[model samples]
Target: MKSESKSQHVGKVTHHELKQTLGTWQLWGIAVGLVISGEYFGWSYGWASAGTLGFVITAVFIAAMYTTFIFSFTELTTSIPHAGGPFAYARHAFGPTGGYLAGAATLVEFVFAPPAIALAIGAYLHVQFPGLEPKHAAMGAYLVFMALNIVGVQIAAAFELCVTLLAIFELLVFMGVVSPGFQWSNFTKGGWSGADTFSMGSFHGMFAAIPFAIWFFLAIEGVAMAAEEAKNPKRSIPIAYVAGILTLVVLAIGVMVFAGAAGDWTKLSNINDPLPQAMKFIVGEHSGWMHMLVWLGLFGLVASFHGIILGYSRQIFALARAGYLPEWLSKVHPRFKTPHRAIIAGGVVGIAAIYSDELIQFGGQTLTANIVTMSVFGAIVMYIISMLSLFKLRRSDPNMERPFRAPLFPFFPAFALVAAVICLATMVYFNFLVAIVFAIFLALGYVYFLLTRHQRETAPTDALLEE
Candidate 1:
């Protein structure tokens, strides 16, 4: 392996590689933390669109998609082990244009996700202190986490581990606390999109709920973005991804079900602080349990918020190193050996999005809901391209060493690919205006890529392959 400081030049682009400092546990922490915030909030919006029963059906379908997607995506991550994640796979499979589409979609997914998490952090804080503006708290979270990420991957990942553990524990406590109050009647009331039985309306609601259902495991794929930073990616990534997905599936279903049954399901839907608000139904507004939930809930939001800052910075650094973005953003900090410029650059974009909550609205959705849908738009696109890349590589590079092949081969990847296509279509149908906004973002990014074509350097296929 080359030194972290080694730079390879191609055309006008130079790559500044990230250090390999992460282990299996740190990778697991990151995999879970990156998506834990969805459990904290953002997902309850599904209840609003699909009703509790309808959303459960939506969530089950999406979970199956992610389960297959992660298993297949791990193959590409272990084979390439590049910080570019899907970009490297797509580039190797279909050349520079494929890389650009995958990279742009990934950037949108990672960059937009943090602002929504930050806002949720603010909302959690606002519950404790009513006078604090959610946007102010959201902006403050970005600054604090960005600094932590800029310091180093090890420290950032360690913090993510601690917070993720706490968040997981708190969620368990929540289920136990509310379990006594749970009733079959409350859960079934207005369950099928406010109808007595399933109908076309119920199906439409389920389709509309796709994005929120997706929130359950939105950025687990981000574990791949840290492939270059892992001590032994082929071995560690598989363990982390497999364990992370199982843990999340159990937690997502438990949290959603228990929260719904604790009280009137409708009240828990469409709110940023659903857990605490649901707890208030059982423990009362002034109870100690309610206070604990309000405080500990921040850990869940923080885990995802901090971990994603780590995810987006690595992505920005990779994109810049490959000349898809400005070269200056690729510079690693000399002392910390981290992508400081990329961390701060992503922070700027997220902070701007935090301020835009009031300025942007689509289909009468809340800022968090709209942003979640937009991020899912990027995610579904990346998933489709990534699965295609997996198939392409299998056919094009028959002899490539694969330490961890996706189980069930074509069956697993094909299932994931088909599900991702269905999700993208459903999301676009329900979120047409937000889809336009997402398309505009991609169009602008593609235009930038075209203008800088002469400066771009595609990383070699064998550059980061492990021995």
Candidate 2:
């Protein structure tokens, strides 16, 4: 409940004793799983601002950014592989204050993402079985996945690998199933709603759509946080990172193109359960296979819901362990060898976020838009800082060993940083209210850290451990 200055050497006193249980493919599962839901739901939001073709253009542009950024990012993760992800890198490159900001921003990103995903999972469930309520389903998912993560990293990674593969397979099935009815005509008719097709309005819409387009690849960098748990962090991390981004890129293009081609792309856009809605075309609305596909698609959301819980917990543990957050948040469950306290803390936040709109009555606007915009805000912040760390470390720590060097050095990372900042600006321009709320949260965290920069780490941490 108190604040403390970050440890002089991050992780020097309270070493992260996480069990190294992940392999390359398993790590890839975490990366892809953390992002699989993006393909299922949020990307459709892009269609609101841009037409089918516009969204495609947005996706292709963002894909190129991620492709460049990930290559440069992997070099950092491989060189300084740690559970802190951006937190650790920022600490090494930008000192403790910078480290705190990076960790806070990452925490914001990972922590906020799951609630949106949990809502999606609930929507998927409700879409399939009308008897089940979305809120109840979302709450239940948080409980199940948190327990799975606490069970064991190896077990969770294996489970994530299975579900992620299932999600990917489902995308392929969707493409095959929908290819028959594909009409390029459907992609354009009434597709560019709410915006002029060839005017300044379309350009504005394209800019507005950028965040949702980035959703397809967002949080894929989360795999780097699992570096501390990978069997061979050096060799395995690069393979997993590279492969994961490539997989998502292919799936993003495939799902968007075919789904829009199958029917009025607008129907799928701006909805929580776009995948299942689109699949209604192949099988009639009430058909048994339609229900089956709807149920199967839940795996995509589950993969993300589960994987991101894993990610945020690690980030939480790393932050608390380094004294940037509550000391107890770093306490590991003795038997489970997992950061149970951190997992529970994040779960509590996520569930609360699931009901934020109802709790506060944010007028008539659904909380998902606010939540997604806020999460993307956090992501853009981390992306900028992480790219900065790559350049800083190259100049500051010349001896750092990078198993995988980014092919085009400064150009790729520099480009990613500039593009990400512009994306941040666009999201803020469109979603100023969400950005204001997010800034308030960040300011509150800073105040806590400033006030409690002198707490005794051991006494406080031990007290919580005993609880």
Candidate 3:
């Protein structure tokens, strides 16, 4: 039998280890899976309520910032090339405290997102069965993916690829129906609300939109989490980041335009599941087919939850490997070679969110806003911290070699950071209950940070598995 290496895989006493390395395509699929959640259902609602110009401008900024941010992360991921990408990078550059903060914030961002995606799935399901219980739908959705994950990592990765393909097909179909209705006049009729929060003047509206926009663009960095699994981390990971961002950007622009032209921007604005409503208005009685389209797109979106759970599971595994989290969390299955414990942890969170919402009647209560805002707000905090880390790393570790550098150096990261802050301000300005909930999460992370600080310091070297 092959002897196990002396390197500790974090605190847990385990003979298991990570299985096969992921290739470029799989890495890209992970990134796509993360951001694709928003494209299918979230974006339309966020942008539609604003006028045509509001939607278009928001789309433009989202596309631009995301493209630039992908490039920035490409550099960071390449420099670190670890499983827990940002956390690993932050730790290496800024030490354990910074790493913990980044990891904690990211954990909150990713963990919170599954619920948002699951809830969206529940919403889409409600279209077919108007009285469908969200809790049951969410639980069902979570259970299906959790089972797929328990099957093994390869299945989870392959599933993500399938989800991406299906999402592409769904978007193309949506574009086909709505693209023809595109009218330049629609875009010229309205302007952004210009609400204030971050920036100095009239652009406050744009600034305020920043946080939610960041939320929408949050998952594009999934390449980092699966970096260790990549067949060739240096090549495939970068390509995936770039390709996924480009594809999402183009698709987002198309979707925004399509959603705008399908009907009056005014009417589509308030509907959370806007595509179905827009299609209903456009195709009249044939809206059933449109509903079918939404249902199909929703399937792809839900499939993404499987990929997300997989990505985050590995992150927790990495965290454990680094001795920041419990060693048991970092354990890979001896046979399946997947991080079973981390997967379970993530699954628990996903199901719990589903179950809690069911019990509290979250959709029927004021807490619905709390649930939605929590994810958005968490993402905003993570994005801001990640960007800030970038600046700090540049200053502190000027000598660190960057295989893939952020284009325009300080300028792009600076701008992206500003954009992220602006988005958070917008959420607050809009009085989104989600923002308040996000503050609560941040406070929670802070508390967790303080609690974990001493433990991290005293963490034994044996707890860190170098391999």
Candidate 4:
């Protein structure tokens, strides 16, 4: 009893306050910037598993899931408005175990995603400077962006807004430059897993491509993680989330369809730098337009990589503050007011993953593809738990002050839940080894939680919920 009291005292002393500086536009920037990198690179990997048409079909299905999920999820984000995002909701709904599950999954998603983006950043850089190793460029990205995030949220968000806008502009330019080259035949040729029509193999490929389809909007929900930093979270969060998702859905489909239609789609299917490569088919490798893509494309990758560093740091800090991680990690920077230790800690893990690209491979997949799959596994798990939390909260805390209620109550959340479950099942079936690795990661975190359960202080959610 004495030790427990001491532990509680230790928790009470840890600083967890964050500056409430973000507004609606900044929040929207973070929401979109957190995922703009998807339009730049990662989604093309889906075209490898599912053919162009199959991947398009897969993308559409996943977009529907995100549309529903974001609308439903906004209610929870605004209601809770905690830095822990899904973790806060799950904890309130299903207690500590649920919180741990959601937190661990969110950590995995945010952490693993950057290394993949880092690699794509490297690949894009390699196009400009033939002598630079992609991995080295990836490492440099980790260092640069992590430091930017450590500086401060206002500075970081402003940079994110700038880069995100630039990335969007570049993508529009890419579409226009490639439009004249687009042909229906180029997009449809071998569109169904190399088959003329959809078959059982096409179905399997489509299911297998779920992870990459998810990549297009993987971190959009991360805006919720910034809610506590928003000036008026209740109003800003809904506007940010709703506008962000719509913007991404339009950009994602346009980029994918345009890039695919601009070339022999299969050639772009298996590459990290698909857009620039597709542009080369029309504009030639030395064309100013192709060079512009290679340079400005960095903005998209930078936006996501930098924004996610902001995100994962908050998760780490929130988890640490709640006693789910080491207490020292919860420390806030005195001057910057940023979670300095948490930022560095997550950066260490990401750098290690970036270096492990060659050493870690499962089923002949590139580290980028494998990590993408792993990240998606965590994302799907979190989505399921969050939706369940929404349902649980409505029943258990019916009187809870909800700023925004999910439209089509139960149906929207229900669809998001079911879609997430299906995506998880299909992803696990296709990428069983990566699934095992992801499960092991969660299991390890859970074991630590169990061992330290007695020492944990009251979670901050209790206080937030009371308010």
lDDT of 1 by residue, 131-206 (tens): 9998999999998999998888899999999999999999999999999999978888999997657888999899
Better of 2 and 4 by lDDT: 4
For each candidate in turn, the TM-score is 0.94, 0.92, 0.85, 0.95
Model 4 superposed RMSD (Cα): 2.6
Q: For all the candidates, what are their Cα RMSDs to the real structure? A: 3.5, 4.1, 5.2, 2.6
Cα TM-score of candidate 1: 0.94
Tens digit of per-residue lDDT, candidate 4, span 26-111: 99999999999989877887888799999989999999999999999999999999888998898888877888899999999988
Error of 3 at 287 (Å): 5.8
Candidate 2 residues lying further than 4 Å off, grouped into runs, are 1-15, 190-197, 358-364, 455-467
Worst 10 residues of 4 by lDDT: 1-10
What value of lDDT does candidate 2 attain over all alpha carbons? Answer: 0.82
Superior candidate under TM-score, 2 versus 3: 2
- The residue pairs that clash in candidate 2, if any, are 3-452, 4-452
The Cα local distance difference test for each model comes to 0.87, 0.82, 0.67, 0.87
lDDT of 3 by residue, 1-467 (tens): 00122223246443535665577787777788777766655554444344455555676786676776677767788777777867776665556666777787678767767876777678667867989987678778877887777677677888888878888788788778766666755544453442212223335444444444554566777668777667777788878888888887787777767776676666666556666666665676567667667668775567567777776787788777655677678777776778888888887886787667444344233334445556566556666767777777788778776777888988888887877776667767775544555567667766766566544543434322232
In model 1, the runs with Cα more than 4 Å from the true position are: 1-15, 357-359, 457-462, 465-467
